[model samples]
Target: MMILDQFYAENFGKVYRSCGNCGTQFKRIVQINDLWAVNGDVVAGINTNFGDTATIRTTQVDGVDDICVKYTGNSNGAEPVEIGSGPDTKNCLYSTSDIKQL
Candidate 1:
């Protein structure tokens, strides 16, 4: 699974907004395409959306929309969560707005 360090390096100036149980600030990030992290809980990709639990609505961070975002959620965890994944993991749409470009 793609760790936070690599994700951060590739997608600089981005922060996970949801403060889950860990609340480690920038320590954890959820890769929606894989569902590796959920509601702040870090887990391996189960190939399931877990029932569309999370959703990131529209919000502004430093007044920006287009930021460091990858086109697809393949290997790199830089893709915008909004772009979503396949049917198997489509429901689990985490808030892309929470991931802001600093």
Candidate 2:
């Protein structure tokens, strides 16, 4: 499995992974296990499902170098789907089965 996207806060984070060929997505919610720095970048230690709470590491990168995710607003009377942590966060990434946002 490879990471598709990730979002992190101080206490917790969510990593999204995709299974190869099958196009299945999995979300892993994790708490901070440890932290360190490498080459001026901060790396986070998180738990994974790869064999008994396997630890995985990640470093925060510049968002300008990453793909842009679509953000939606709830002004058009269409119900905005909750994709991020909650509605308060106002962060969403979604796609519908029909010809809609992706």
Candidate 3:
């Protein structure tokens, strides 16, 4: 399955995967297995239907660069929606989205 977006936190041993086409989103976690475990001392898995768990090897995956932008704010407003060139201007990328100010 193709993964559309993924988020990971270092040392958390957790991975979040989101697929747009299949409408499937799930998280995988890795942990140490108890003595009764059969496969190995450490196990990584994700749950499927019927409460079944499938063992998997989790790895850090990185892809294309993401658009990381910082939004600034002011007491009145953060950014101006329109630009100026004799009234010929476009809105900033962050102008359309709803954002909160502190």
Candidate 4:
């Protein structure tokens, strides 16, 4: 008799984003092809249509795992940011940082 088995792994990361317009914090999930290197050896990337903000921070999920993206931002005025999965579609996730007034 013979048997077959399969295994899988769950990969996740964190992508940080700060609003250049209102200092709002945002985050999104990093896809497989939406990844880039930043600051030499630091994995960085951004979700273009993440939200109303223009710029954002992207980082690896873990020190080893290079999947998913986590966002960290202020919590004062910080609120959930919209991450667009497609045209006219988006998901909401709260920032992991506190907001500061400038």
For 5-74, candidate 2 gives per-residue lDDT tens digits of 3434232222322121223323323322222222221222211221111123333423211111222223
Give lDDT per model, in order: 0.29, 0.24, 0.21, 0.28
| Model 1 poorest 10 in a row by lDDT | 35-44
Query: Estimated TM-score per prediction?
Result: 0.20, 0.20, 0.16, 0.20
Name the regions of candidate 4 deviating beyond 4 angstroms. 1-22, 34-39, 45-72, 75-102
Q: Which candidate number has the best lDDT? A: 1
How much is 94 displaced in model 1, in angstroms? Answer: 7.8
Assess candidate 3 and give its TM-score to the true structure. Answer: 0.16
TM-score of 2: 0.20
lDDT of 1 by residue, 23-46 (tens): 121322344332112122121122
Candidate 3 segments exceeding 4 Å error: 1-4, 16-44, 47-102
Residue 36 lDDT (model 3): 18
lDDT of 1 at 82: 37
Kindly give the stretch of ten consecutive residues in candidate 3 with the minimal lDDT sum: 83-92
* Candidates arranged by lDDT, highest first: 1, 4, 2, 3
